[model samples]
Target: MVELLAGLSENCVRLLDVAAAGVLLSDGRGVLRLVAASSERTRLLELFQLQRDEGPCLDCFRTGTPVLVPELAATADRWPAFCAAADGVGFRSVHAVPMRLQTTVLGTLGLFGSQVGSLDRSDLDLGQALAHVASVAVVNERAAADSATVNAQLQHALTSRVVLEQAKGVIAHVGDLTVEDAFRVMRRYARDHGRRLGEVAGDVVERRLAGRDLLEHARSVDLLPEE
Candidate 1:
């Protein structure tokens, strides 16, 4: 994932003829972290955005829109800290595009230049298109991970329920009680023993807990449900 973003940022720099570029992603705790950069200088500059909180990437990510600084020298008053830092790093201008998918803003793609100038209309459009693709890729990756977790949980629940039902069947046959009553007996035994319902049920199905023994235990403990 880091390599993918680095490649994309580098390609953006080459395509737009910029001096450097970087990608910043939210850490999901309201802090932005630099995930990729075109150069070591660009990486340091991007990391500084978090500490200073006044860089184009910060603004672009917060507003979910593009931030263009045609001339960094002219923006000292607007972003005193960021402009000073950029100047020290040999950057004359900067442009930042938000990586967004519909209403979700994932991150920002920042471009730096050695000369003061703004991107052309076409270049701005292309930059935004690339950002949008990155946003989709990130969103899809998260969704896939979430789906796998849900599937595993569902499978576990299904397996447990199957064992419980089979245990109830055995209990009903041996105790001469309804399936509902057998389930109540099993549930009570699990609760009293501080054991998981699935574990108790598995024991009954495997004959580790004999049906007749469980039936007698349920009666002695008064666990059977009323008719």
Candidate 2:
């Protein structure tokens, strides 16, 4: 991810002839955070964007679309804070490209130009291509992470199931009850105590919870008939 950000910043400088480049990514909480920049000045400016909450990057991220400002002076009324701050830092123009997948925007890539003029069609196309590639990488990475989490949860559920079955057998032998009754008692105890069934079952199997306790809880809850 770090390498990707660095490449993005460098490519923007080379291909767009911008004075500096920076990337800002959403924190998944509707706030843009600077992740990378081609130079120290650009990094500082990007950080300022977060503090002020007004910049081409923020606008692009919010709209899930590009924001091209050919002249900073021309946008001073629209983005006063951003334009003033950017002008103070020696930038005359800025362009922002959204890193997006379909309608979802993940971030923005910002370009700072020393002179004011719009990017040619070729430059705009290249900028979009870069943003597209970055978006795909981010989406794929997130999908892989989600898949791993699902796999881990499935494995834990399987282990819990095995432990629950063993607990049912133990309770049946200890309480002189059928396996079905034992399982019912365990489930009732867990529900009454606001604990996970797997946790209650593990305790029963380890003898941490006595068989008498399980029977008492079941009777208290009217989940099992008296023998």
Candidate 3:
């Protein structure tokens, strides 16, 4: 599986205008860890984005959808920290393709380009194929990792879901709103604050910040309503 992913990354670098390529695998609880990269630069960049909790990769992973940013400089308003950091690294554009099987999303494949341009249809199609391959690689890796405890898979999945639900409640309470409204508020906060919504939600649930304090902080940051 590792060799396959390495081959795919090499193919992506050769076939596309991307300077760097990477695959990220999500643990199903909003945590995406790097699985593979075409080069050291790609790995470093991905880790940087994950640590900062901002970037197209995280967006794609969260939405379970592709994200194509044609011009990093022009999209500064949309992703302030990500744009600045990517530009500093000489990346002018980024594209992220989600790796999904049916309704289950496994991860994301991200491409970084040093030039600015919209991805053509062919590029999009190729990216999707790569994402599919990445998904297969992730599943294989997971199977290998859990080979000793096959029966625990379902339990782990359930626990992850429970944690995610608790995190959602934390967001709702912190924002002083309904669940759906809280999600919207959290998403908006993520966009404006240059952080991932899941990370913020986790912090809320872990009691790192009080619910009322979160509400007040959100208001101060222009993230949510005062009430």
Candidate 4:
């Protein structure tokens, strides 16, 4: 996701005719965590805004709207610290577009400029379009990660179930007992030994020493209730 955003930031500088560009994204909980910057100065300016917690991007995220500052000088009264920081970094103007997925605002896409002028209608529209693309990219990346985690968990469950079934069949045949009784005996032994039933069943299928001892113990302990 960072690599894609870095490329998109470069596109902003090239196509939007902006001096520099940076992308800032929140962690879905109103906290900015990721940044894709076109230059070192641009990176510092982004960090400055995050540290002070006051800037065009912050406003854009809060309202789920675009914040365009054509001339940073004119916004001194509104964002005094932000204006000063922009000047320090040699940026004269800035613009912010909301990075949103549906009605949920994720963060902001920031554009920095060396000159003091607003982006025209076409450029402004393009900027917003880029922001939309970035929003979708971030959300989809997160969704893919969550999906992988769920898949791994489901696969583990299926494998364990199969192992347990095989172990039950082995123990039932060895002990001359019903499959259900074999399972109950294994469950009791596992609980007494502070182990999982599947793990104990695995030992039985593998014919390990632990499996031999468990069978002997189960027989002595009574494999089933007497009528």
Candidate 5:
């Protein structure tokens, strides 16, 4: 099953105008972890995005909708840090398509373009088709192993736990807190930062620039009211 999914992902990398491609599986709380990428560079890109908690892919996964960003330069303000970093690396555009089955969202398939221009209708259609295939492959794999509901829940839980543990470690190191306290700190940080908790957690795990600096910045920014 894993082999089949890997093949599907590889095919996606070849079939699109994207310079990089990745497949992520959702853990049911709006977090997608990288399952595969077309190449090492693509995987690194996905990891960077996940750790930063910003990017079209994260947006699509959260909204269960597709995101097409044609110009990273002109729209830098929309995702200030993300745009800067992505542009620095020569990725000027991005497209993210949600991988979903019915109401169940499996994850997202993300594409990166090194130039700026909205994807034409044909490209959009192809992106959507690829996303659908990836979603189906994930669902079918789970269903074949057991009842759909059980398998789905199990997968989601396992993925979420892995992400959570990694986030806890990040928070612990950065905030100088224990694991439990780190979780609390992260929850608080997410709420105050106006971001999803799991997304923040993923960022911490990935050690993105933002997440890596979050604790020091949090200290400087005054997280609580002064006495």
Candidate 6:
């Protein structure tokens, strides 16, 4: 994945109307991390964005849409830290394209340049195309790699699914809730308490976690439906 991201960022600089480029990809849970950059300054700038949790890539990631900044100076008010940082690093413009395929957003492809002009429509289109290609390639590579563990994971998941369902039924019965509400309640507890859903479900299925107790937890967290 790092190799792919590195290559993609390099290509964005070499082939597009940009002086530098950076790539930021999200983990499975949507936390963005710096993947690659075309230059040292660009790398540091990307890191700054990650640390501050602002800038074009972050905005694009949050909206799952492209963030095109034709002129950094013009947009200083919108992203003060980012503009100041870019100026410090000698970047005058930025264009952030969403690295997404369909509804799933993988990350963003951020193009930067020393000049302060926006890319033409054609250039922007090409940038979007490159980002899409990178997204597809990354997804395919991951799918291939995950194939090795797919069987084992599937077996465990199938067994866990049964236990999870049984636990849901138990919670529903004890809480006087529908199965759907029972599932939401269970998931909320696991997430809030820093436990895995499957582990908590296993406990409930094994009678380790009582359904009445689960219901009480939901009520405490205000996760229960209003009567």
Best by lDDT: 6
Number of clashes recorded per candidate: 0, 0, 0, 0, 0, 0
Tell me the spans in candidate 4 whose CA falls farther than 4 Å from its real position: 141-227
For residues 109-214, could you state the per-residue lDDT of candidate 1 as single tens digits? 9989999898889888888888777766656645534545433433444355567768988998988887767766786787678877778889999989888767
lDDT of each residue in 1-227, candidate 4, tens digit only: 44457667889999996999887766533476435677668877888898998889889888999999999999899889989999998999898998876776666889998999989989989999998887676565455446354334334433554576577677777667766566667777887789876677677777773554667777667765432
Q: Work out the TM-score per prediction.
A: 0.62, 0.62, 0.60, 0.61, 0.61, 0.62
lDDT of 6 by residue, 1-227 (tens): 44456567888788888999988777544577676677668878998998988898899989998888989999888889989999998999999999876676777999998999989898889989989988777665445355344333333433564576688789988888877678778878887889888899889988888887778888888898544
Q: Which ten residues in a row have the lowest lDDT in candidate 3?
A: 149-158
Question: Which tens-of-lDDT digit does each residue in 71-142 have in candidate 2?
Answer: 999989888988888898899999899987665667799989999999888988898899789767656645
lDDT of 3 by residue, 83-103 (tens): 887888888999999987666
Q: Show model 1 residue runs off by greater than 4 Å.
A: 141-227
Score candidate 3 by lDDT: 0.70
Judge candidate 1 at residue 97 and give its lDDT: 94
Each model's lDDT comes to: 0.77, 0.77, 0.70, 0.75, 0.69, 0.79
**Residue 161 lDDT in candidate 5:** 48
Write model 5 residue lDDT over 1-227, tens digit each, in one string: 33334455577657777776777776544466776566555666777888888888888888889988888788777778778877777788888888877766677888778778888778778878877876675666446344456356537544654686687777677556666556556666776779766677677777663553556545655752222
- For residue 125, model 3's alpha carbon misses the true position, in angstroms, by 0.4
How many backbone collisions does model 5 have?
Answer: 0
